[model samples]
Target chain A: MPEIANTAAKVAVAMTVNGRLVSAELDPRTLLVQFLREKLLLTGTHVGCDTSQCGACVVHVDGAAVKSCTMLAIQADGMSVTTIEGLAGASGLHPMQEAFREHHGLQCGFCTPGMIMTALDMVARLGPDLDEATIRENLDGNLCRCTGYHNIVKAIGAGAAAMGAGAKVAAE
Target chain B: MYAFDYQRPAALADAAALLKADPEAKILAGGQTLLPTLKQRLAQPTALVDLARLPGLSAIEKTAEGVAIGALVKHAAVATSDVVRAAIPALADLAGLIGDPAVRNRGTLGGSLANDDPTADYPAAVLALNATVVTDRRSIGAGDYFQGLFTTALEEGEIITRVDFPQVERAGYAKFRNPASRYAMAGVFVAKTADAVRVAVTGAGQSGVFLWEEAGDILASDFSPAALARLELDPADLMSDLHGSAEYRAQLVKAMAKRAVAKALA
Candidate 1:
């Protein structure tokens, strides 16, 4: 057998996830997706493709949306992390998630949560006025095998509208 | 994936020192390639130096000279950033056109250029922009950095910190993407500098990436796609793959070069 590298069973890592401080004992080789699923038990982040090609394991890392599958759990040490579960605030559901549900945005729902997270990031960047082509182009990262994306686009548009209306209601 | 030692050093120098000390260690940027390779068991580095946590490396700044994009900057940040877009809209376009959204969010300039995948979008534009890749140790020209398929001039433990692109007067990038993967089947970067013109063609060359010499010659004559198409790229030297044939890619090179030129001038 070849000589193996050092594999310390447990390493201490800290993270600020969704406005909360967290520390966990993690394996040296543990991936972020595995950590979310196994260690932290935050299973809203799904792992569809081991390769970064599939956006099923998407999350908001340090306020930017990134594919969680591609990252190591240790890579996120001392960082702020957010999963699909973090999208909803004190409110019942995130406008994007609500819009997704209202517009029949999910079919298998395997890719829905990540879709919502990625759309949240996109909405944060492009704002409520994102057009159809830009939405399609921006949504290219998330893959939904079940839904053909017709309703997903509508969901994003409606989500933006909902977000915009919320802002208006808050102003009043 | 096999177990491995991992380090995330805060300082850029500390990261470089770690690599310099360990020859077998690989630099992990964005994990767009390294993690996938690890999962597939194609690559198992004894140790990985994660560049993600390094500070002062992901800066996209504009000086009087041109734009300097940190190697650690993700493709999505590059695509969405107004600073990057204003300086090199073609670069933003190239960044957006790279793999789907997930890949863009996770892939960094250094990872793509370091991997030097022949079909990657950055290398073509990097060469076309005549960007200088700055490593912890040295600054390498775009021509020198790229050698061939899966090849680069980087030495062991050399970490690319940033890429400095000399702002061109007008530029346009066009790509005929592989439908499924979105990697450029054939892409062209056409720039109109004050002194002269530069045309770099990628994804269609067996030599990996080549300057369209004949196209440049035509552009020198008229500086238009219509003028450039008069001089055709030799299909014999082009790359033939599962995606496209040598002759067909050669034609696309001509067409894309023309479109890029038209877009730049427009």
Candidate 2:
């Protein structure tokens, strides 16, 4: 909520990330991508483009997926963010990750993390009715130079189905 | 990006005051534009006013009049919000069509309107919806808000607080997306208000967005795509680049406008 202050001003920023509180004293110009990669050593988020064109740097801010490259560390102050590394638990890989592995959705695996994060958000909102057109429409933002999106779409469907089945099993 | 001073204020007044104190400082919303520009060294601000900590800046409120979108609300939030999807589907459509997943998740409507990129989709919505751009100091209407390409009425350090779109009878959005960037090659927004039909075209215009009076006339009379075919697009006003020609974009504006009307009427 900070307003525009004098150019000489500096401030401390703190954020709760992946259920843990982390604090940093950073230049206001430090991007959230730099902070995550260079500072916190969370290299799970990749930087594919200097511009915001690629979805490689996507992360979750307060449960909402956002591009980390387009954000500042200070902007995340007092906020909560979830990155790719945070998706897995002691139980093992998140359902989306397992599905990607099973589906051969990745070739080089560079875009896998961002793709998985985006899939998690899309499945939660779109449910299983996310047909081919819907998946194409939804994933237009995340680019894949390897062009491995055909399987990626299938993987997302399989993952959502698995998650749905898991929910059903628990309910039963 | 070079290092600079950063401040986070938890209140609106404090943020406004800080902006008032430092005109050179840039207000950070989603950073989808600012960060990239910074990395490109196109824009270098000595100070950064981080607005993410401010409360009530990300809410989508449904009022009796219309819908109010907070300035800091992400494009993804607006595109998926129940109220926006129901009240102003074109706004939601425009929000959903922005760059891509990452861009939509971090880009804000306010930021899009403020940036005034010719290829940006929200300007068409702002003009067609006739929304009010409310800033820290005053409110500006869509008619006068967008000056030209990559230009807006906002003074240095001014922050857009909320955008208020008055309820219209029917509205829809249509776009011919650029293959590589996914930005609109030409996008049109058509809205039928109680008083008159408003048509706005973006991406294919030289001056960013322009009023499509002929298309508006067509909508006012028939409100259909077939009616749109009768109106002619002047080649003088269309934008041209690697993606399309001025004449090509002019035709697309008409085609997209027709499609938008068809969708709206449907």
Candidate 3:
């Protein structure tokens, strides 16, 4: 159990994060972003813009990519959440992470976590046959000021293929 | 964010009870807008009645008349729903265009309609499609739902159950989004029903989402983009901001209406 709120307005929340069942007592007003970063120490989900415009805090809530900044911790009670840290298996980096590394997809790496999380979602939804235009369109939510998106787009396309192959390997 | 008591009632009836018990309680839908508002201290509620656990409130079901989307249905769900695509492709497109993917995954139909932000996309669809907003207490016509900017006809304790959209002959929606924020600068939804034609506009009006009666009347007789050639919106009734001038929005209204009519006919 984690204690994220000291106030009397604390509410109990139990949720799954990164394949672990974590429970905490937090303020009813505690945002999911704060719960993840301050309480759970999952700082990989960055908070670039507090206004929900920047997708740096994007994470999977019950398998859908959502801005953690805009959601309350209590809202996620009994839900499954996956942050950027959860992408890799015990063996090595996730295929998407490998694709980004191979393609030089990051610059400052601040937006990489959110970008990777968003890419994982896109690959899951659209499958491996993602075009440049679709990738660009889908990246509308995540903003990266450094890479100019050329390398990031390439990384996502390559990552999509690897993820598809990875799924096939597991299925086999 | 201000401290508040959180309540997650398993049943809608229990949720309504909690709401009725606490006057300062607010219904927490998807929390895309409400949470941000709370974080900014724009609103202070004594309690938040979480409706996420309410089972039937999130379902998308086809009715005898048309499609009924549960109030808790997220924008992404609506955007990707097969039923919505088959019954109302325009609606799906509109849902897809709302905010971004992450925002869409969390923003709900009920929250959007309940908040009734002037620039919101759903109000235009509700108005143009002549949908029925079913609430816990009673049903409200789409025409009567919206009152003004950030306002709706819903009572303090009323909870929206679902929105029922009738099967129209054809419908289309188009919007010019503000690039930075993605809020609609000017959005229009045009629908041709069995008995009448409706044209609704969101984002451009100072008084909030409004019906373009002049264009709707013209399209009722002659439903085509060319039919709007003689029609023009009064710039005085439109909103002017840094993104666009009143005159520009007036022109956009006509242009978007034309495009919507074309899409409906397509």
The candidate scoring highest on DockQ is: 1
Candidate 2 global CA lDDT score:
0.83
Question: Which candidate model has the greater DockQ, 1 or 3?
Answer: 1
TM-score of each: 0.94, 0.93, 0.96
Per-residue lDDT of A139 in model 2: 80
Scored by CA lDDT, what does every candidate get? 0.84, 0.83, 0.92
lDDT of each residue in B66-177, candidate 2, tens digit only? 9999998988888888899888887787788788876777788777877889888888988998889998889999998999999999987778889998878999899999
What lDDT tens digits, residue by residue, belong to model 3 across residues B1-266?
A: 76778998999999999999999899999988888898888877888898988989898988888799999999999999999998998999999999999999999999999999999999999999999999999999998999999988999789999999987999999999988888888999999987789999999999999999999999999999999999989999899989899999999999999999999999
Candidate 3 chain B weakest ten by summed lDDT: B1-10
Where is model 2 chain B poorest over a 10-residue stretch in terms of lDDT? B1-10
How many backbone clashes can be found in candidate 2? 8
Per-residue alpha-carbon lDDT of model 2 for A79-144, expressed as tens digits? 898999998889998888999999898998888888888888787778854677788777876778
DockQ of 2: 0.52
lDDT of predicted model 1: 0.84
